[model samples]
Target chain A: MMETIGIWVAAFLTLSMFSFLYKDNPFYKFAEHLFVGASMGYFIPYTFFNVFIPYAYNPLFLRHNYWLIIPFVIGLGYWFRFSNNLGWLSRYPIAFSMGIVGMGVPMSIHAQILVQMRTMMLPLTNINLILIFIGTVSILLYFFFSKAHEGLYGKFTSVGIWFMMVGFGASFGYTVMARLSLLIGRLQFLLGDWLGLIK
Target chain B: MNFSDYIQKIDRRYIFIILAIAVILPLLFPLGLPTFTTPPVLSLYKHIDEAAGTDDRAVFMDFAQSPSTLPELYPMDLAILRHCFLRDIKVLTISYYPQGAAIMQMAISEVKEDFPDVKQDVDYCNFGFRNFALRVPITLGMGDNIAEAVETNAAGRRLENLPIMEKLKNYDNIQVCMEISGAAPGIIYINYARARYGVDVAIGVTAVSAADNYPYLQTGQLVGLLGGLKGAAEYEELVETFANNDIPYSEKKAQNLSWRNQQYELSKVPYKFKQARIGMDAQAVAHVLIIIFIIIGNIGYFIEKRQDKNKYVK
Candidate 1:
């Protein structure tokens, strides 16, 4: 009985969301706003109970890792952004996070940068690997303003543009598939679960 | 006005209605069109199979997507979980998104219902919903020691005590970490876990975001990928074709690594597992509608340009 009720509620919301295609209306607005509002409601308490209490409160109070109090206080300083006078206090947390992020730069350089470059230096006998090598170089060359794209360089730059178009085409195709899948999912709920139209 | 002008001026709402019918019809009557398995999907399936006999070897699945991305990513998770469970491979799951833990529970319970004898805490373990804030540390930490990294399961049970974690000292024991997400959260595993410890990483992402991981797969950073609904459908087919859900635990150890692919019977698959393929049928019809529109629109556009050029010449 509860499952049936749940399906009806979901079906109503799905129809409400689809109403936007007709034009701007109250149903669409209600569905859109409810989605955003519910997300916030779910996130706030979830963060507190799962993240704050476990990673923060428990570590300082229960585990007695007193040093955590320093970062904890800095984290609280973020709430000061709400107050005009004490807004400057928010900089502490921002600065602390910035410092931590800065420390991660070296890590990113090694993994994302250096390692990726190593993979490119391959025996490009295969068509796939050969295209990857050429594609990377040509795309980089297209961005080089030092040499005018007027001769052989122009041909290569044009090839780069072709490569980019193919990449963009693939991305756009995938986007369409993703959107359709989301629609199919909702339709399945309505038709299969609610109306008994499909199994 | 000419045909070109009429074509150009057609209302978009008509197109929407046509698309609606095209997609809706497929749902009402499934075409059961075959889902072709790609290499990336095959690679991940084979990687999971590598851990078939071993109790120590495991696969870490990070549910890094929200309910918003559920349609595409959820089926992949279910198919993957089913694969692992069928092959007698140990499973480890963690959720980095807010809704992830709940999603993980839902998928597990649904899949678990089919395999009642597959015990938890032994065959599988889930250390649920650590917020994205802890993502970096938790990912890197798990490389050295998993129990130390996660600390506890969703049930507040220690990972150290779980039978599943016995031989799992680090990433070495794990086959690959599959980040099932809408976005590229798999990059985290690649950068931190794989880059640092040489762990293999696989990604299952929403179709739109699948393009982002292509470069990684080409460069060998990502071991394999499952892209959107098509990906999920392919995985379900692979599981149906290869995993052979009825194969006993005793027989799984003797299974060959070079298991040949068989024709995936769409009708033979359960309805709960048929969601992705049914969705794919809708996708196929929808694509046909779009393609026809694209071709007509292009012809109209070029003809209009040609007519304008002739007028200017005159």
Candidate 2:
């Protein structure tokens, strides 16, 4: 009985959201505002209690560890938003985060980005690999600047563009598939799990 | 008004309405379609299996998805949690989004029914959400006391008093850290946790972010990758293959109870990833529809371009 009630509430909220499709009406507005208020109300406290206090403070004072306060102060610097004179205090933490993240960006790029590019460039030694290699080189040459449209380079480059277009088209197709899958998941819940219309 | 101008000015509501029907109709009547698993997702499952075989292994689940992408992430999260719990692996879930915490709690409870004997703090814990994604790990890693950061587990208990992790020093004891996350927190895990610590990382991310993680996978940094529901469904299939063949408890327990006994019994629960499989089917139909739309759009473009060319030629 409780599960049924909860399901109905979820279904109603979902419908309220969908009401925006017809027009930007009151129902959609109300739902959107309610969601915003509720989310912010929940998030601020959650972050403080779960992550801030125990992970930050407990080890610092309880364990007699002064070093822990470094992050604590860095985190507290974010509250400088409330201060006019000391508002610049927040930048220190932001700068620290950026610096650390900056360092990581190159590492990740080297390991993840460069390696992936190399893999796509090389390809496995197979029939598909041979085809991909030929296509890639031709595509590269298509942009070659020494001749006019009366030559093979111009035509080959056009072919390369077509290949790139098809690849991009496939990627877009996959994205559509993923989004559709999500929509199906929610609808399935409404019907199969909630309404028991479909087993 | 001109015909071309009128067609171009079709109401925006019409697009939304079409999208609604397109989404709704598929749900009411599913078209079962085949799905093929990619190599990265397969590797992820194998890595998870290998990790679980080790001692006191823990997987940190970050549930940070929102309503817009709910359909995709929920199924995948449930599958990974169930797989971890069934093996008596320590599972710790932290939510970066407030609403996501509730969702994670609800999913964990539902999945826990399959493993009745699993304790709250001992085998599983919910650290809930704390602000500042970078701060949580930085503080925890610094102090060697993560429980001190959060006041209570998801069930609302004093973290210091929790029976679980009373013996552990820090996250060093954890063998793996798997994140079923959305965009922002996924980057957090990669940047802070994976880079700083030597923790084996696996990611179950939304489909949009899947390609982004491919670079990480190619580098052999991420052991496993679950991209949206399809990846979840694949993992389910892989786990289920082994879940069923485990030794039965009744006849075997009469002889002696071993460490594997707890896990064998947990595996008795059904191993179907119903949601992800269903979502995959819907996805197949949606892709076909979108492809049709794209072709139509291109045809319209070509027709306009050709007409312009003819006018100039004359």
Could you say which candidate leads in TM-score?
1
For candidate 1, give the lDDT of residue B104.
91
| Candidate 1 docking class | medium
Predicted complexes: DockQ each: 0.66, 0.37
Cα lDDT of model 1 by residue, B1-314, tens digit? 89999998998899889888988899999896766667788778877888897988999999988889988999999999999888888999988776777789899999999899898899999887787767888888888899998877877677899888889978998899999987665878887888788999999999999887776887677888999999998878777766765443222322332332332442366678767888899999988888898899999999999999999999
Residue-level lDDT of model 1, residues A8-96, one tens digit each, is 89989999999989899999999999999987676776677666776788779988999998989888998999898999999997776
Q: Name model 1 segments beyond 4 Å from true.
A: A126-128, B246-267
lDDT of 2 by residue, A14-81 (tens): 77877876779888998899988987787777666665565666568776789877877887888896
- Tell me each candidate's TM-score: 0.92, 0.75
TM-score of chain B of 2: 0.79
TM-score of chain B of 1: 0.91
Question: What's the residue-level lDDT of B185 in candidate 2?
Answer: 31
> Model 2 off-target regions past 4 Å?
A1-3, A55-80, A83-86, A89-170, B1-22, B51-54, B135-175, B184-198, B244-273
lDDT of each: 0.83, 0.65
Q: Where does the lowest 10-residue lDDT sum fall in candidate 2 chain A? A: A107-116
